[model samples]
Each structure stands twice: as structure tokens, then as C-alpha cells.
Target: MRQVPTPFPLSQRIPEETAFDRRELAAILSLYGRMVAAGEWRDYAISHLREVAVFSIFRRTAENPIYRVEKRPRLRQKQGMYAVIGPEGQVLRRGHDLPMVLRVLERRLIRSVD
Candidate 1:
């Protein structure tokens, strides 16, 4: 088959997909490991979309995500790129720093041994 050239330039021709870099994934996975050890999280999933990258945490494989850590580059200048969302579709925290935003969940982990 012959290739058909589009009107858009080479930069526009390529589809953009958002994703987590190694450092970002490292931080997220570090928290995930702790949560798993604490028995707060079990199953997990990662999604890379055109607009956002998401890491969903689940208590069980069959259940909806208990939390979602997402990165939206568009929001970087406005409300920051990193966000942590709760199960009820609420934004738990949003910030320019991934570790800072993740502190919301860390607080929960540090509270009460029970």
C-alpha cells in the first residue's frame, strides 16, 4: 500500500500520548509498595491517554479504583500537572510536585495503627 501525506506537518502528524517518566513512576510505585505492605492497596493499573496519564489503585481487582494519580500536562501552568483523585471522583490534591500532592494519602497512612 502507498502512503498518503496529510496536510498537517510532521510534528502534528504524530499522535501525542501522555505518560509517566521513570522518576515519576518510581515515586508512584514506591508509595504503591508501601500501601501494599500496609494492606491498603492490592490491584493497580496504568493508563496513558492523549491528554492524561493515570495510575489507578484498587483494593480488589473487581472493584473500581480506590484512588487515581494522574498527570495532565495542560494543567501544568494552571492547577499543576500532578493530581490525586479519590474513589468518589473527587480531587484529593493537585500540585506541581508529585511527592507533595501524594502527601495527602501519606497522611492517611501515618494515622492510627488500627
Candidate 2:
């Protein structure tokens, strides 16, 4: 039998999907749990795509997500891999560190009551 060349090299292959690992999820969930307890967020969705992974926070089931946290490895060098986007599609924060990027959202949790 003749040898057949593979489309991709053995050393390198296309990423099937990008996902959050246990540690990353733990951090995100910690924040999520706090928001849930604060009654600010009600639901959430997670998406793993070839280029990016997203964790979306929703205030209700039917409406759009209030916030979207994304991980883009491509931007790891220039803009960092982590980002938090607001509902209006604005980049609320971006950084190499997940906790730092998430601080923008955490600020909303802080409010004094009369």
C-alpha cells in the first residue's frame, strides 16, 4: 500500500472548538453565582465556536443577553484573549486576565441602599 499524505500536518491541526476549562469556568461561575444572588441575572448560555468561546448572561429567558464574555485566542497577543461585551455590542472590558476583565461587570453589583 502506498503512503497517503494527510491534509494537515501531524504536529498541527485545526481547532475543533474553543471552550472554557475547569478553572476558567469556576471563576466565571463564581461571578455568575454572585450576580444571581444579587438578583441581577437570571439565566446564562455558553457557546463554543472554532474561533471563540462565549459565556452569555441573560436577565430573562426570551430577551437578549445582558452581557457576553468571550475568549479569542487570536487576540491573545495584541488585545488579550478575554473580553466582556455589553448588550449594545460594546466592548466593556478586555484583558489577558479573566478576573480583571470581569471587574467591569462586578462594579454593577456594588450599590448602596438607603
Candidate that would win on TM-score: 2
Clashing residue pairs for model 2 = none
lDDT of 2: 0.95
Could you estimate the TM-score for every candidate? 0.86, 0.92
Q: Give the TM-score of candidate 2.
A: 0.92
Expressed as tens digits, the lDDT of each residue in 1-114 for candidate 1 is 999986877766544799999999999999999989998889999999999999999999999999999999889999999999999999999999999999998887786656
Q: Where in model 2 is the C-alpha error above 4 Å?
A: 1-3
RMSD per candidate (Å) reads 3.5, 1.8
Using lDDT as the measure, which candidate wins? 2
For model 2, residues 1-114, the per-residue Cα lDDT tens digits are: 999985878668768999999989999999999999999999999999999999999999899999999999889999999999999999999999999999999999999988
lDDT of each: 0.93, 0.95
Give the lDDT of residue 34 in candidate 1: 95
Q: Which ten residues in a row have the lowest lDDT in candidate 2?
A: 5-14
